[model samples]
Target chain A: MSAKSVQMVLYPDTHLDQAAETIHRLRQHGIDDRDISVISGVPYSDKILGRPMSWTRIGLIGLAGAVVGFAIATSLNFGTPYLYPIRVGGQPFFPIPTSIVVTFELTMLGLLISTFLGVFIETITPSYGPKGYSPKVSDGHIGVLFSCPTEKMDEVKKGLEDLKPEWVKNPEAKL
Target chain B: MAAETKTLSATHSASQEGEDLRQEHLMHDPKPREEMNGMVMEAMQTTSKKYWIALAIFGLGVLILLFGFWGNQIITGMGVTGKRRPVFWALYITTFVFWIGISHAGTFVSAILRVFKAEFRRPFTRAAELMTTFGLAAGALFPLIHLGRVWTFYWMIPYPNARWLWPNFRSPLVWDFLAITTYLLSSTIYLYLPLIPDLAMARDRSTGWRHSIYKLLALNWRGTEAEWHRLRKAINIFAFAIIPVMFSVHTIVSWDFAVSQTVGWHSTIFGPYFIIGAILSGVSAVVMILFIIQSTMKNMKYFIRLEVFDSLGKLVLIFSMAWAYFFFNEYLLHWYGGYQAVRDLLTFHAQGPTAWVWYTMLICNVAIPWLTLWNRKIRRTPLAMFIITTLVNVGMFAERYTIIPLTLGEQRFPFDWGAYSPRLTDISIVIGTFCLFIFLYLLASRLIPLIPVWEVQEGQMAHSTRKLGKGKVTSVAELE
Candidate 1:
């Protein structure tokens, strides 16, 4: 199946609400949900934009990191005697009470570092090439973009105009 | 205190008569967003001859005092710092505790208030968090410089080596390593996460290399609903986790002293004592920074108003009371037990050569704040609050100094007891750290929007005036 792609831009702040209305209008016209995109300066939630929640895989990754950290700590605490043993203060080589601190610290370190990595991975941050962007978004604006069949472009633009956007224009998404 | 209140109210009324200034000075005098933006931009762009002069002085201080002086100390060994027998932990440790205490305010303001949804906390949380990061950076240095054998510092880590000498995890020193590092990471992340949106704003507004830098930092954020949800969720987890982490970090730091077998250091109450001391010093540090930001930064005067100072003063007052309570508990318990060594230590702290420091700590930490903060007028006055808060910080510094070295100076064995006088190198390094903190803060203020705009707009949305019967009162709707 060959599908044609068409694009348009709306002034982010004034046109976002109308663009959202147009997306609803298009969904009724049988456009798939995946064809629509909304961008803004501040984080606009999925519920507000009528989209599904994006899941973060931070929890699984963080747990994995913690386990690895715990393993290293455990090995260090228990394996030290076989590696090189020395008695101190007439106590045994491995002290249970003292080992807890090392394990706890490493586990925490793992969880935190993984969480930091998770934010970047989940967000796919630092993408700097030209996509669909508008300056008004920074000034408390929101923009919505949707793809449609080339023949239906005028109809969709008309539908968007009826909802009273600030302005709408076709723009290329370079990269 | 009541008498002070009357005197202050009289002064307020007199000032009102002179200026005829209304409560509507900044809030009701609302300006356009564009104008406000220009004000902020201009503030950042505009530099005075005096600013350059001051920067030069601080810059020179940093060069000579921090690097040059620290190099001298490192070269001369720890001996140059006057850290002789029985006074092993001297000026460096005192500054460590002081800097660490200064750091707690940032997390307290940003995380604690963030947890409770305090509307007034909006504008200054970032400013306070910057304090936390910079203060922690400065605070971390004291320990490293104190180490003397700084190159072998990695031995503090618990990593297994060929020699297989396990790090003593039971020691509070090890805990300090873990806890402080955790705190630095957590606070830095917490500071950066909320800053992403603002960075995006700067990216949009800026040009050239600045724009490129901001674009990279802003990431590809488009404020999608899912993105907002994830960001909020991450922030929520951090906010909750960081508070306990903040508490534990200082408690563990307190353990550095409390775990010791020495007379004054062995108190069980040191944990709470240190926590209160941290809050006390931290809040004061916040007030000082807020005052500077408001007076010096352009549109900052609008954001950081009398209400903010009023709220901060109230915190200062409450923490002062808490500090007094902790001090009384610790002092009474020691005095009541009549242990000779503890009693002697207490006596020497009060009447020995360093007695002046004890009194100064009391005056700055307790008396001055207790006397002034009772008055709403004084609390509302930025200059008064700044002076009093500065005093509180000085007093807190003295408290730490007395706790560490002065107490260490008069231990059970008189044969080992000795006085500590900070050498020139010790003094310079301390001055350098202070300069470094202020220098970093200055740089940050220029580069970043010190006021969190989203948080401010959120607060403004929450706040409205409602009239009832004969009075109009401002009320806030809780918004997360």
Candidate 2:
């Protein structure tokens, strides 16, 4: 597969709204929102960008983890006593009060661990591969990394430049 | 504390360099995002000689007192220290509960403020979160140190041994262990999850070894919209879900004592009493640390402002009142019951040789907060808040001393009762742990961005001022 980053434009502080307009321009020019990316130092939600909300599997993963954690908690809490059934003052084999602690801990444990892993899995983090990233983005520049056709590259650059971005860079990625 | 800051700003305040007077607030006067990033990075990179000297002292203490003394105790049996008769719990347990109390503030301050969307929480969230992880580490250590046979500490695990006897499901120690482990893991993960974006930011601007380290930690984040969505969702889940877990951690820690048959420790009110007391101490510790950081660290004055100290002081005041209520509830119950053992314990706590310490504890924890924290000037004053919170911590330590050692030493049952004067080694070990906590925190500040610059930037994005009738007021747009 071959992909070329059409243009990278830097928008300063409040002029970040111009980046939104450029994103709108990209969409109007038949660029799929998925094909075009908005990169910035800070996180901006879909509302700010006027883009569709991105779906995430993190919540579902957390819910699944809670169920699994509860199951483990139940097994440990209920089944552990009988394994070593030496009577200690004739207490109940398994008490609900003690079991509640284990279950609660496990449930939260599962939620957090899964939510953490969900980030790595869903976001495909730790990706050291060649990405169309710019250093200026971290310096508070609002950058838009968009993909356009090989032939239409000039037109895309012209569109972004019209928004008066500080500078636009062309990128080449080969796989 | 406020006076020190007044002095510090006159002397130690980082070069404002033509910064607007209004820009003293982190929110109202926003710096260029790039400039803010530079400020944070510079703070991490630049370590003063005073910082290194403090670090060297803490580092030496950690190497010798924490590890060396602990190693010596591990070789010699548990007999070298103060554990004897009824007071077998002694300073170890006291310090354990103390560290655990300190842990609660970080989660309470960070998670509660985040859930409520209190904008002032922006700058100090990372600092408080760091305290949570490090404080738990310190708290977990006291238990291991308390176990004279430290190597076999894994015996507390629920798995069956060769005799096939598993850990008793009914033990509060097991519950405390579980809660601590769960909380440490949960809070550590919680701390790291949001730190990812900031780490990525650090990675973007660095080269050489620093770049490689940040690159690996950042998980190659590029701040894509999908990535941000998932990150935000996960952080939100942690924020809401972790609150109950935070409460459970401290409550279960209290159960370790409340479940016991000891005269003063066996109170049903211990759970809420411990929670309230924990918050009082925890919030105070946060203030103490924030005061130090704001005063000493480079460029921190711009982030940690008077409003932060003011809000935190308000929280300390509320927790102090709640603590008083819970303490009074326990006191009245024992007084009304007229049990001889309970009566003896109370008398010893109040009228014994340590009576002055007890009265000072009351004055510091209850009377002083009631009298002073209500004043806005005092609350806003960094120095005043520091003194008040420091006194509250002293009172809290005194409270622990009264509960654990004194109550255990002077018991109703004569056979199991004995005085527990801590050996110098025991005192050093506790001091070592304190130094280790500070050392770990000092090291963390250098590595991680203490302020979440991205979050601050996002906050700056959401926050703006608008004209309302005749005056301008700050308004924040809900970004999510």
Candidate 3:
């Protein structure tokens, strides 16, 4: 039977150099990249940390939202005029120049609203339940959260401790 | 040996200069993130007796001037104010445009600066963004206030209803509704996205009701690599997308006048002219607010340094020039075209009973900025900047006054021509909205983190002084 997984937390200072070295050491251990996460006060680029780029569908979702907005705008500008035709002078039922304003406004509205929702969706936010988190991470401390087999926890902890983290223990472990 | 001694002295001087530069710029001055977080939290928590007194005054202004007059107007009707046939759109619309112009300050400072990678925008981006949200809130009220039957304002909404009558999309009024709604939502979201991490920072530190509210608002942010990555990507997209939206909003506002049959109002230049005016006024308001924040808030002196005012002053000067160019272009074209109605209006504006408004616009927007902002010493002085920026807004208000009521007063036919002036209701409601804006900002200052501490920390991390020749220059690394 496979050994049950246990999450370990390694707290480093705000500097990227130390965080990079710690991440490198974790990779040298049998830990896969997917099992590791870095929590930080400030955002550090993936290249600096030597970590693979984190994938996000926010852009795609925003584009899809723009498309939806465009459709709604079109329906309002072109489609609705047909429902209740209020002819003004000899102007067309749907003037292209005038319609552009509504179209552009709605399209951007979609892009922005959807992009905002994308953050919530991608992050699975508003999650109030318990998880592996540390308050110190927000105080400019870089926290490396990774899971390893329960049997290998001590060995990984020993490797991480050599780097002199502020603390290293089970994330859920009570202070 | 003499040459070696001279070289050592030169290097020492250059190093000293570099240290001075570091002290001057916020980006070069590094502070521990924990300390920054604490400073921001302390600023939010700490409120003096003066703050309460000021809040009470603004709150009373909102209740009495805004709500009280607005209620009186609603009960009495539109006849309480000056809204004659030719001069239908007056001070209410002028104030609306002014507030909308004010809203541009946030987008200009936050999104535009972010896109250009201007490092000086780091400390007070949140302050400007809050202005955008609240400014829009204030501006959005004018449309309803202008309405005779304010309850029927929902007729502008593009929706299927019992009447089955859809709003005419061709109308600029409808366009205003759509554009303002979009800009408000987008800017609010933009504001919230960046604020999440800060909310998390606040949440981690606080307890009781403050902790609960912060936790809810923070959306359970863990500051994980994935959350930050997505947030950064989203913010980048917003920064680019929001600029054009900002332009479109003021442009549509200009269209509300431009599309009209009124002689002075109908001009293609109005779009860009209005936009430039909005930016000028917006950026100036930002400086004024920054001055207030720096003076009032705790530990803000470190974040909102002289360098920010200096940089923003330069922008205000450039925008002032741009506004002057557009102002001159519009007037010159109308003069050169020699249209009778346009000629009469232009002549009246310069030499009419209310020509002081026109002169005030020129003196405040053009003369004051051109005269003072050129000097580096004046630009760096916060008190001077606050005074100059305040005058600029006064000038912008005068400009809007010229465009709306003054222009409307000048009819093609002499028989139809009549003067318009704001009644007690008009003056009171306008004051109310101003009070409401300051009131919202005051409440927000105590509730939220006014500075983006992480962005400041990030900028500090990226900045370092590097020696080029005899002198060391400030160098910044492109982190993202």
For candidate 2 chain B, the 10 contiguous residues with the lowest summed lDDT are B12-21
lDDT, candidate 1, equals: 0.78
Model 1 lDDT, residue B424, Cα: 86
Model 1, B274-328: lDDT tens digits are: 9999999999999999999888777677778898899999999999999999999
lDDT of 2 by residue, A1-175 (tens): 5464555666875787898998898888888877777777777878888887778889999999999999988988887766766665857666788789989998989988998888878766443222466666777887777767677777877877767887555443210
lDDT of 2 by residue, B1-480 (tens): 999888788553333422443554577668888888888888888888988999999999999998888888888878888788768888989999999999988888889999999888899998999999999999899989998888888888978899988877678888888899999999998899889888887887678999899999987776767778888899899999999999999899888888878788888989889989988999899999999889888899988999899899999899999998898999999988999989987888788887876898799999988899899999989999999999999999989888888888887776766778899779989999999999999999888999998888888778776767744567888878
TM-score of each: 0.89, 0.93, 0.97
Ranking by lDDT: 3, 2, 1
For B1-480, candidate 3 gives per-residue lDDT tens digits of: 999999998888877786788779988878888999999999999999999999999999999999999999899988899888789999999999999999999999999999989899999899999999999999999999998799999899988678788888889999999999999999999999999999999999998999999999997788877889899999999999999999999999999999988988899999999999999999999999999999999999989999999999999999999999999999999999989999999999999999999999999999999999999999999999999999999999999999999998897998878899789999999999999999999999999999998899889989988878755778899877
True contacts kept of each: 0.37, 0.79, 0.78
DockQ-based class of model 1: acceptable
Give lDDT per model, in order: 0.78, 0.84, 0.90
Off by over 4 Å in 1: A1-23, A44-51, A63-67, A76-82, A89-94, A125-131, A168-175, B1-39, B160-162, B462-480
